[model samples]
Target chain A: MHIPDGFLNIPVSAGAAALSIGAVSLAVKKVQKTIEDRLVPLMGVLAAFIFAAQMFNFPVAGGTSGHLLGGMLAVVVVGPWAAMIVLTCVLIVQCLLFQDGGLLALGANVLNMAVIGVLCGWVAKKATNFLSRTAAIFIGSWISVVAAAAAAAAEMAISDTAPFATVLVAMVSVHAIIGTGEGVITILVVSFLKRVKPEIVEDGACRAL
Target chain B: MKNRKFIVFSLLACAAVVVFAAVFASSYPDGLEQVASKMGFENKMSGINLMGAPMPDYGLALFGAGPFSTLVAGLSGLAAVFLATTASGWAIKRLRRSGNG
Candidate 1:
């Protein structure tokens, strides 16, 4: 769901860019009152983990492989605001280093994948926690990925990159499955971290999980 | 663990993980690329001419993966995390200090 360069028109991209920046700023403000110094490095480490995890592409149905976007993983491991910063770092590195995404389209990519993905993923996790872990992770990840994809597809549609319905279907349907991978990976990683460093969660340093 | 020292250790540990990730990453086309290939847009994929970028294709434009590629991508990811997190932390700190929290 990383919208490469030239996928969206300049105006639509710029609009989404502004929204992303605004959301990040708001996230920082929201977390500042509660953020402790100890959480900073935790967030950074989680970001790096996300960066690495994103490199491993899992095979989806139809022989296509999709990697963990880590928006949910980061949020689950850290808080949402810090996750934003963390995932932003991952996105920037992936784009500049791997040529996997575009430099000019960084704003749109972050908005869709980092901002929308983390926020929606966190909400979905919270909503589904009443169910089993498997169900929670599966549904949470599915919703987040589909939401991000839908947002990206909307941007593309508004930008006239592809027909609205085509982009929506292509992105949402595929990402629906991709979200399952995301959910499982997120739950496993968070569970591992919780076992190793329970204090991070016990102390309220990690909230999104 | 003290806060400052823990942070340093976490950073180093993340750097190590990045190396592992780059090395162990599957060498296959990702979801988008696969979809594009199947959907007939694969031919439209074009290389960007970004000047002097490091570690293109996770391998500095080299053909195959190796320790060098892994190390480079790992280090780059580490640097990015450091820069972004530090900047964000400082910003948060500054905002708090300004009584704007």
Candidate 2:
């Protein structure tokens, strides 16, 4: 979810922004080393897809809506480092052009979705190594969404934006359902790619990492 | 060039989704927005944004508040992000090449 301006206090926002800058810089370096030249267009297309998919909000409970976060999907298609770059670009564009996310809050939003979400997916996949790739993708994508929501809720709670328990429960509960949607979509897309172009799914560079 | 077709197909798929989303996305408040409203912190949101976006809320005022305007906005956004990311990837590749050289 995109956090708007004035949601978190200025200090928290700035702190997150600082951390985000460091993380993104590191990601750029890692991507440079690990991303295959041939995958560049694929990464770009995936970023665009993530941006477009974010526009469609499927209904959840109580008139609320949710959309695809695509952090883990990026990680699955590309490596974690490239996925970070893709997500960072998407978040920045959403903030600057669409005004979907607040500029000041861009740091927190990127940290939540790009860094934490992708990392959670990476960890989930690793933890579920014994399972099928499709299952791993599904679980990883689901965890990515829910974890990002949890991070956002924690930020809000720390900023005194809302009660910690209430925000955590509300954000997690709604996002858990949304994450299932993410899981299914990720599985389908990965499966399709696996069927159509298995070579692109090899991810040799990422595998080495 | 082995993956050229796959790349083209993926980009086209992304474009199609963008158009589809512009035409058919729900108009309800998202999870965070809904939660913020229920928790009584929705008023914390103000018109005070750091940057004045040309297309606020992903709609072009010039075209009025309709699906066409949203479509225009989504397409533009999709194109902008695609170009930005592609350029970033190119830059990174160049940097890597130079480092190797």
Candidate 3:
């Protein structure tokens, strides 16, 4: 969920932006040391794919629509570090080119969807290690979407933009349904990549995925 | 995976999805937008967007507000992101190589 401008006050937006910048800088450093040269092109392609996929929104309920966030998919395909970069790239393009999300809120959007979302997905997958890979992917993707939404809601609430309980409830309920789409898509994509391009999987920074 | 083949496949997939989305995406407001509308904060959206995007709201002015314009917008966005990311990857590679050297 892309937060538009004026949704949160300046303080929250600036705080999120600062956090996003710090996280992205860390990810950039980590990726420089760990990212395989062969996976570079794949990272770019995955970013483009995520950008394209985000364009298509399916109806969730009551006229609300949700699209694939692709955070977990990116993390699984690449790694948390590179995935964050990919997502930041996607978010930047979306803001600068399409005006889909607010430029003022770009930092908050990136923080929620890229850094927090990917990290939550990675954590979820690791936590569910006993589960099958497919199941873990599903759960991880779902958790990532819901967690991002929750984080956004908390930011809004903290900003006094909306009532905390109401915003949290609305966001979580709608995102839970939206998360199912993310989970399914993630599983399919990971499975397809694993089948057709096993080497990419083997060579990825996140070997577990 | 073969690098060339992977590149081709990825581009093709992105192109296909861009075309498909241009044709099939729902015009309804997304989750956040919907929530904003419901919570009566929809009017609160106001700010100086840093970029005066050539195609604001993913519609091309030259093509008029129609499916064709949307298709053009989607394809152009797809191309832009693809090139941007590719260039970014190239830069990162160069940086890594220089650091190693």
Which 10-residue window of candidate 3 chain A scores lowest in summed lDDT?
A200-209
User: What TM-score would you give candidate 2 relative to the actual structure?
Assistant: 0.95
Docking class of 3: medium
Give the TM-scores of the predictions, in the order they appear. 0.85, 0.95, 0.94
Worst 10 residues of 2 chain A by lDDT: A200-209
| DockQ for every prediction shown | 0.45, 0.70, 0.67
Tens digits of per-residue lDDT, candidate 2, B1-101, equal 34677767777888788778888888889888988988899898865756888898889989998888988999899989988998898888888888841
Global lDDT for candidate 2? 0.86
Q: Best by lDDT, which number?
A: 2
Top DockQ hit:
2
Model 3 Cα shift for residue A187 (angstroms): 1.1
Root-mean-square deviation of candidate 3: 2.0
Q: What DockQ class does candidate 1 belong to?
A: acceptable
* Alpha-carbon shift of residue A39 in model 1 (angstroms): 1.4
For candidate 3, write residues A1-209 as lDDT tens digits.
98878888889999999999999988877777765666677887898899889988888789988999999888787888888999999898889988877887899999999999999998998888587777888998999999999999999999888999999998888899999999998888877888878765543445432
